[model samples]
Target: MEGLYIEPTETSPKVHFDPEAFSFEISGESRPEDVRKFYKPVLDWFEQYSNYLYWLTEKYAEGEKKLVQFHFVFEYFNSSSAKYIMDVIAKLGDIQKASPNAKIQILWHYDEPDEDMKEAGEEFETITNIPFKYIINPD
Candidate 1:
């Protein structure tokens, strides 16, 4: 499956969903005027990717386990964007639950001295059951 890539906008983040790498990343500020519109495609892509992966494994009879890595690193976001972010995390949790053999990791990256970003990551961790890693990157 081809990867879904969206470049960062003035009011949005850079999105990189690479199936080959089994990695997805959303980073930067998000304050899009139309939150739903901006995130709908991303949500759809996740659903499609999950289904494709399931089919490929079942059809090919691959014994290897499939894992997806989601990286969320936002310097700031509005409340609406936050809701969408949470929704994405929930979707990933659902995928993991449905596919016991499939593991999903949520990596939350934040600026080392940014207290707000750190706290935000903690908040997400509390809400989602997915395994999360908090990474501090110095600007």
Candidate 2:
């Protein structure tokens, strides 16, 4: 299955979802003028990816769990983007729940001293019930 990749812009984030490498990342700012338009494709991609993962798990890795890493490295984002971010995380949680052979690791990256960012990650963890490994980026 093909993955999705979107370059970051002044008002949007970078999205890189590579199934072959089993790597995913969403970084940079996210406050696009059309939030829905910007995130709709992302949400759709996740839905399809979830299905693909399910199939792959059942067919190939029957007894083994495949580790998938999702990285989030945002410098800033607005309220509008937060809702979609939550949706993305929820979808991931759903994927994990549906696929017993799939394991997801959410890596939330933030610069040291960004309390608000850290708090946001905490809030996401609390709401989604998905444990996130917090990584402090160096200057």
- lDDT by residue (28-109, candidate 2, tens digit) is 9999999999999999998899889998887654568898999999999999999999999999999999887888999999
Best by lDDT: 2
Error of 1 at 90 (Å): 0.3
Candidate 1 lDDT score at position 136 = 84
Segments in model 1 whose C-alpha atoms lie over 4 Å from true places: 57-64
Candidate 2: the clashing residue pairs are none
**Alpha-carbon RMSD to native, per candidate:** 2.2, 1.2
Q: Which ten residues in a row are the worst by lDDT in model 1?
A: 55-64
1-139 per-residue lDDT for model 1 (tens digits): 9899999999999999998877789999899999999999999998987776666555433466765678888988999898899889888887776665566788888888888887877787789866688888766
Give lDDT for model 1: 0.83
Instruction: Please report, in order, the local distance difference test score of every candidate based on alpha carbons.
Output: 0.83, 0.94
Model 2 global lDDT (CA atoms, 0 to 1): 0.94
